[model samples]
Target: MSTAAKQKAKAAGIRLDDDSMDTPSEPLAPRTAPGQLIGLQGRVHSQQAEIEKLKRALEQRAPGKLPLEKLHEIPGRRRRLTSAEYAELKANLTAYPLAQPITVRERPDGEYDIVAGHNRAAVYRELGRTEIDGIVLDIDDSMVEYAAFFSNLLSPTLSDFEKFWGFKSLQESTGITKEELAKAAGISDSHVGRIMKFDLLPSESKDLLATCPERLGSNAAEQMAKAVAEGREDKVKAAIERLVSDNTFTQAQAVAATKADRAPRDRHEPMVIRRGARKVCQISARNGVVGVSFSGSAADEADQWAEKIRVFIEAELGKQ
Candidate 1:
């Protein structure tokens, strides 16, 4: 195997012997080296021992009813469900028994950190149930995060925004690169990059997304991020706000809103007071400011003209 492949296998807790062939073309010959045969036997024994140990650990932590009060929720471990979805889940649980037990890891503080099925536990609590069906996982703190991430990532109902946040949390916790994350998640590098654009959104927009992750998708988020980078942050925020508030608002329309043009302001044409062919004075108004320029000999009459304009304005105001 290549060095990179070996490294990846090692990370996943798989031992890759350098001399081992992944796909042997023919069966081992009777004249094969005795040392190689002995090595293979030793490896098989070691693997069997490990498997037995794992089975024992699993038996010790077998699924059972756990106290609801002792179960603790870990942030970023569970994906948020929409209100209607939560209601639906609760109704299903109420009508039938839990199909799958929740996965949890026992903490030193006598509490269990939820590894998966947060919504299930919550619904059980709301139904006034004292305990829930759960199984304890025999994983360390580092593996706990990986377990939670994979469980949530594989969920069909998980939104792209939620997936992005979960991937981000994993990256921050493990200091893993994007390529490594994509490999770990079994997704493409470009897909990871597109989902990560949600990070480029403004803080307020992110806050809104936290409440409704399904409101916007990764593709729309990419366009909005581009708009924000081009100094259209306020418009992007407005688009997200509208998207969250209005049920009929589409993601494409939200993206278009960032590029929407504002209403044009009223423009005034410049006025020039001239004497036949000789230009006397020119006046212009722009952005609430008025400017006047005198031409040639008209420059000498600037003060008189200013006094006359001030008197005319004062007389107009007095009439009002």
Candidate 2:
């Protein structure tokens, strides 16, 4: 046996040359059942269906389950549709005939669930269109998520006042939390809270409050509410006018006022006592509360009074 012959024999798994080797063994295919094949195919089909659903969601413009029909009236909505809005919708429909299809989900009863397009749907109803262009959505347990409220905070095509008040209506009806509402509306919790407090404002104040929640915090509105409740509607109106006329008495002022039921300040929280231009006493008091004690007239006098209070407080603490 030469080297070549030996190599050939080793490769053959037998002590023989390649030229003398027998046919090689090949791998065999395992038999598969028709039922098993069908099941596997079904799994693949199911996966494809899931992918399509994801794609649809990615392509969707609105959030939540399937959208509602345009023809159906929005249900349980606290905000009434304004005449101006109705007219605007009518005008848009007359001009464009609803180029965008409204989103809707089929209900058990022939009607459909509306997800978005409240305005368009309203227009369609007023137009007497029995059926309109729509995108049917099948919302299985999963809901589409939304970004911020600014997306939904578009002007109502009615009035700016309606926008804020309408937001409150929508939030209450939809059970959306104040924090969530703030996030959606692209505002602070304080801002949302203030806007929601507009109901406490006078008819004259609503416009100003809506335009300036920073100046009309919950507490301040409550103050106005308290005053109005206390048979001081005139005073409340005066306070609101002051707010509108000047950016003073906003936020903390409003909040403080609203919280108390016409309770006089100096009862709770720190209270500030005016000492005129003389050397003063007491502490810094804002939003109806003051701190410390002593007397002062000017800023320098106030500082001296503050120092005296501080010295006395330190002396008392030292004794303790």
Candidate 3:
């Protein structure tokens, strides 16, 4: 067996010896190392042919003007321009009139499938424009999804909520894993996980975030999620209420306070010293050490009490 194969077997917790290689558990195919090179050459040529075909298609069909009614939106589009942005874009387009052409793919049903520029198209339609300039490309079904994903993902106006949902929608639409989505979305794997943490919030919390997404950020959302996970939903709700009412209230402080509330107490309870049914101080002791804690007027008189305790100890020792 080759060194690579041996390493693989070792990784699988299988021991392979020289004799084991001679008589394998399963019949192995004859090594076709040279044939693999030929197969690779054939694959290269096939890929080159495919690329050439696509190039020819692009060269033959240039961009043209298409009616707005003929264009159709993809199933999942993440970019949603705000009303103000839409109005601004419409005004700009009306002034400039066709600064850039939107991209679309000609479908078999005679309707053009918009790959990018859904927002631009909507703006044009809102302006009562009949036809808009578009670059019609011949793209495969797989590339269309990628086209939509990259198009909306690169938008400057994309919100964090939109981005979170974009990753989710693309993963569901394309059946891709989080790791794959992370790479395509140009973010770290944990970033994807963190964005997904928003979903853990209750509907009331989610609605609160939806109103002012910029109010509570991902870190706050994570803390809130942690609070929920620890069965501190009531505390989290109170924190949210405080957050909504008080602008000075911080999420970090809320998370810290919640965690402190849940912290395990010391095994032994402190003894309370009282005066006339009124609490004065608490004395805590462990092992060989005795601690006296004083409060109010008792604190001012602690020195005298200490001297008396020392004398008492001395007298007890003398008697013993």
User: Which is better, 1 or 3, measured by lDDT?
Assistant: 1
Q: How many residue pairs clash in each candidate?
A: 0, 35, 0
Which segments of model 3 are wrong by more than 4 Å?
1-64, 73-79, 91-101, 128-130, 137-146, 172-177, 188-190, 202-220, 233-320
Model 1 agreement with the true structure over 207-320: per-residue lDDT tens digits: 787778899999999999999999999999999999999989999899989995778976788899889989998999987888899999999999999999899989999999
Using TM-score as the measure, the top candidate is 1
Rank the models by lDDT, top first. 1, 3, 2
TM-score list, all predictions: 0.54, 0.34, 0.46
Give each model's whole-structure lDDT: 0.77, 0.50, 0.65
Top of the candidates by lDDT:
1
Lowest-sum lDDT 10-residue window in model 2: 141-150
lDDT of 2 by residue, 123-163 (tens): 66666666666665665422211111122244333333344
lDDT per residue (tens digit) for residues 1-320 in model 3: 53223322323441111123556476643369887666545544443344344435444556689999999987534244556777887888889977556778888899998887888888888889999988787666534444554555556655665556455554443344677667656789988888777767765665555544444666777877887898888777676666656668776765665553656555787999899887787888777588998898889989999999899999999998
